[model samples]
Target: MARNAGKRTSTKLVFLLSCAGLLGAALIADFLWASSSSHSHAYASIASNWVLEKSGTVVVPNKEKAEAVKSKNNSVDARILSGTFADLPGPELKWEKMAPAPVPRLDGSAVQIKNLLYVFAGYGTIDYVHSHVDIYNFSDNKWVGKLDMPKEMAHSHLGMVTDGRYVYVVSGQYGPQCRGPTSRTFVLDTETKQWQRMPPLPVPRYAPATQLWKGRLHVMGGSKEDRHEPALDHWSIAVEDGKALEKEWRTEIPIPRGGPHRACIVADDRLMVIGGQEGDFMPKPGSPIFKCSRRHEVVYSDVYMLDDEMKWKTLPPMPKPNSHIEFAWILVNNSILISGGTTEKNPITKKMILVGEVLRFDLNTMKWSVYGRMPYRIKTTLAGFWDGWLYFTSGQRDRGPENPQPRKVVGEMWRTKIHL
Candidate 1:
């Protein structure tokens, strides 16, 4: 555990606020910025630190001494500090095991609303891909069944977002092969507990990054054909007649960095795209050879921001190179918390391991500062904003024989607080 400047404390563990209520700040009314770098930049109040669970404790590390606490041994899983950024070690932040999912789920999306964690649409091993929806009550600590997807989708990139009413399930994969992608959108109205298909996107894309601003759902770059193909265009969808209607998907704004199948989130009214494979990764829509680039299938850590006016600008890159859909970003107290996601290679086994590292970016500063790593390396872990804490779901370890083989998924959950 590390200490900070403004507040110095000797307490081993503490809970400052509920996870959901911690980052309660006035949303930036507009995207404003001065000429500092290449594009428009805005300044906002930022919380000082981000807290995470390591071994069994909660730890809060600030900008001053961030590099010291990036390991599992020092990680804490302190249960009391579910979402508070306090000074504890990795041991204090690890959470206790809760009820297991009805069945093991992979490639599903989870979102929390009204104290319930809803997980939907994922595939499983042994020849089963499900659209089965499950709900976990954080308060009561119980798992309950919800509605299931009308269709079965596997390897589909699930994008979950909220407009205070329904949870939107955007484009994903389907079919026995689980290879073809679909642009059809689905809405899960928590109020009515009904699922309805929305308008299909102009182009079918899966694994597209999603965000909501001003009640509009923004779908960023995704694989146009499949997970292997990337699309740089962005689309906007709005609710009309109780269904999502595609207003228009404009490729007008050049991305701060282009290449599709990226991950994104909304914070300070700016759509930030994180790590994704870049280059001509997408096949020519109707071609068979699929596609490979003269450029290596390299990973990226660059972060880009898209404004309301569809302007693109680059932000500071992540401290390390990362690819894959294992990363998560959430806004808490004017700060963006990034968790999980692996580096380019594994350190010990020399094979890739699911990463459990955490990083926090202050929206105001536009700089990335290391938060802390998890006790175990987590790859393919689900990161979501619940209550106020950042929830990191199951991921795997890399003890395999290949450069990226022997991957295993963990069935545990961890939470941390943003101390901004």
Candidate 2:
């Protein structure tokens, strides 16, 4: 009985020891696994060298070499930065070419209504003012000709907006020359395909940024005669029953500073103005033109927002100074996407350089970031957004960086899928 008791005790001791050994091994393995997993997660968040390419692949370059290159160059390429640093968390964007517009044009205004897009007057191929109103049906993907806008009402550098049924155009140059600013305002009934003149703007200006807000048309700063003389007057007109009921322009708070080529839109019930040129750009010195100075055109990077109380507040400026007379922009998901525009103009040649970089501003954060580059450099184009896609129509393209003359206009159209 003693021998049997000793054997039983020994076996019990061995079994307990074996169980303890297995538990110890498991605990060590679990600790190592957890440590490795946490290390990988931490590395991913701080990986500033990685970039999300258009193919949706994350690329990590040599950290030391990339930093060296960035230091040598004054500006860093935002596209090569890591996903976390770039804040590009959305799906990959794909740009696809669409049907070309019927005629090549620039500095045109486009508004989308239902399944159709209406393109208004612009500069034509012969450098002549055009009154063509081209209707593009998104459903059929074709351009259908509409009745031309009245010859007197035809002009470029105008402010245009739509209240669903009626399109309002205000303040533009009556002729192709620089000294033809007009205060005439016209409204086009989309159903009637006819135009009716409304009360003229209180001030004669060209390219004033306009938007329809709370059943009123708000027109902001623009150029008075030449690009240098900017008008700071801001005015609004109330509309009722699809017509301008208030014939007199009601004065609102004037813009703090005036600028030409300003782009305005209403986002989150606030009026926002984007890029423009603040002052006149004179010819460089020693040029053939007498009395010329070396004053270069000043493109603005500043952004301003008007609150409900008609108070203006400056927000973070754009990534760079831009003064492109015409560009495409759309408000989606409380964010504004500004596409291709001109960033600089040669003081001597007066040639403009088109920037292909696409910029996005988050309303919640009030910060701007580069989204990506467009497929091609474009400016003075008509753009509209619908059904998760942005459509860009005819615009002028830059020939080259060395070219001294304005590039030819292109009638090509393109569409890009944007995932908010």
Candidate 3:
């Protein structure tokens, strides 16, 4: 009886020890799994793994697929063909509606100073040229009426830049009718709400590309008086005390192919010229002012960069021939984000077909990629970036194929949080 009791005690002790060991192993496995899951979520959030599929759609892979790609050779093509590219979840670009403007406007010049956005002259209802200056308070997110521009300064297609305290308004058209270009320039002190006329541009032009770089105003290609002849001329002038100096403008290397409504941005101390149209507004044949035999217009996809030495170098052309002149662009994360331009015009209808696609160009790789498409077609809008967000003001929308003048003006305002 004593031997049987001792045997039973030993058996019970063995069972307890085995149970403890299994529990300890299970706890370690759970801890490791939790840590790995947290790390994966963090990595997926920061990585640029979202790709545009060949079907003109954007796809974001799930965590399982993302991890699988990371574990393999990391070839995007291979992962895409692995039969897991359908409906995978990922980060997406989000757009939010903002306060609308008081009136619908287009082709205006916009500049930001601190928490204020100053919108200059633009075309309003019935194509009426507006001289009123509409100010938007970033804090309040509302439009506040301000002083009107001088009667002479009331024009659209103007170029504008700001130095945080003052805004410099450059050349644009004058009066309601699309008549001729104006060399007039003006400066406004935001604090005083006062306006002062500055030295005029050397040549009369409208829709010129202007930038304030290193205390100087760099003016690039624009259209001449006829609107048909695009100028290849580039000039720079010294700006002092919120006024352009009396010194003559210095001429730089001319653009290879001058374009009207071109976009110029200062990136990494280099001036980049985006898409523009070569021949626009050329008078049709049998008109009183027909100067050239060729009246057809050509939109260019070519890009050029200007360095500090005043040398011009050509860069790779964009994938698509985008030429919606006077479009808006913003620089984010060392990449240029261009939105709402025209890819081409209808050959027979002569109507401008808006390019609904959004594109991004990486400065590091010198490559262009399609980011996504806008919810609706937008063109000739004023865009600016503030507080890591992009604001797009009033612009024109496509009125479909039935309308004669298919471009319909709108007063919608939109904003989006920029992630890349």
Candidate 4:
């Protein structure tokens, strides 16, 4: 674990205060920055000190440091579970483990289009990022197809979203761990299974908050490579049918916070940004290769929304901070429900704590609540909503600073029933 784990621990994890109560509402009469969370910038299941290289062992960490982690106390999670989960107005929820991925993964993203679930680029082991795509058939409950992303596509720290049959993948770290980012953008058409290159992002970033807003694709807040610089730049472009209508991206309102690994969503016609951290690692200066940041990372619970006037307003903070949950959210029954990501680090242990609550933000109450409890804690989880089931899969498991899950990186999919 890195330093500053207690108060300023890095959000090397994902966001809705770590994402999604994902309800977009405001009791905040004040214009405020939105909350967000994110995945640790495409890291494998290891501590922050180990460096991932392009040709070296990216998935495996240094053995000496890896061994040191085992000596830590394995106390069960000290965080309390909500007694109010049962009180939430929904049907009973039960979780079941589905078939695991053919390969393990972390810091990945997924999209559900029609009956197929598309699992896209991520690190297979730390050595390199996978450009491959895996498609799971909901009807068959199995992985039915596999393909590859464009060579120009980003490997990790990606900003992605779906509009109809097209998936827009935006700027992100292009190479292996902690490397420089790419300004390129690509769109994948699920129906045709083809990719089209769009005008590149004007500014490159890591895990930026990308969303499809009214008539344009909006991208905001990521980090500057080589330091923990939180980028506030917002850019957009006009697009139609998976093709860029504009030759270049246009500038928009800069986000108030460092928007890496956060969730940006539109609900009830309001645009919101939620739960992400500033500062990942400060890489050693002037190294052509990669190592680690000299500083620690910090996760937060701030939240903001864009009002009808096209300006931002502050919403209430989540009860606790969450990270590594960039896509772990779904809209159901007018509420934003998010699940499974990292929270704060244990004060004494200084190790990261994975979240176990199934959190909800109600548009009706304009409030956040624990709607359910997780089967276990996980991070970098991809989520989806289909029929009446809440589904999540693919993330790194905490190896028990408290209760651990599968002990390492995983590919298992889990779902719980929660009818509207």
TM-score for each candidate, following the candidate numbering: 0.66, 0.72, 0.72, 0.77
Model 1 ranges with Cα > 4 A deviation: 1-95, 152-155, 175-178, 240-242, 245-254, 258-262, 279-296, 325-327, 346-353, 385-388, 400-406, 416-420
- For model 4, state the Cα shift of residue 379 in Å: 0.8
Native-referenced Cα lDDT, model 3? 0.68
Off by more than 4 A, model 3: 1-93, 282-295, 324-327, 400-405
**lDDT of every model, 2 decimals:** 0.54, 0.70, 0.68, 0.71
Name model 4 segments beyond 4 Å from true.
1-93, 285-289, 404-407
RMSD of each: 22.7, 21.1, 21.9, 18.6
RMSD to the native, candidate 1? 22.7
Instruction: Give the alpha carbon lDDT tens digit for every residue of 1-420 in model 1.
Output: 354632444232233444334444322222232244214111110010001111111122232233333343442222222221211133334444556666555556667676777776565641345667777776665676676666533334666676656877777666422356777777778888887776666777666677776556777666666455457666676664346555555344545444443556777666778876553223335445332222224467888877767677778887766555523555677877666554543221122324445767777787876676555554555565655566766544433221123234445665665445
Give the Cα error of residue 36 in candidate 1, in Å: 58
- Candidate that scores best on lDDT: 4
Which parts of model 2 have CA positions greater than 4 angstroms off? 1-93, 279-296, 325-327, 346-351, 400-406
Clash total of candidate 2:
1
| Tens-digit lDDT string for candidate 3 (28-108) | 999999899678644432221111101111122344655566568542322332212211122345778888887777676
The deviation in Å at residue 246 for candidate 3 is: 3.0
lDDT of 4 by residue, 292-336 (tens): 444556788878897669777889886678766778888788998
TM-score winner among the candidates? 4
**Ranking under lDDT, best-scoring first?**
4, 2, 3, 1
RMSD of 3: 21.9
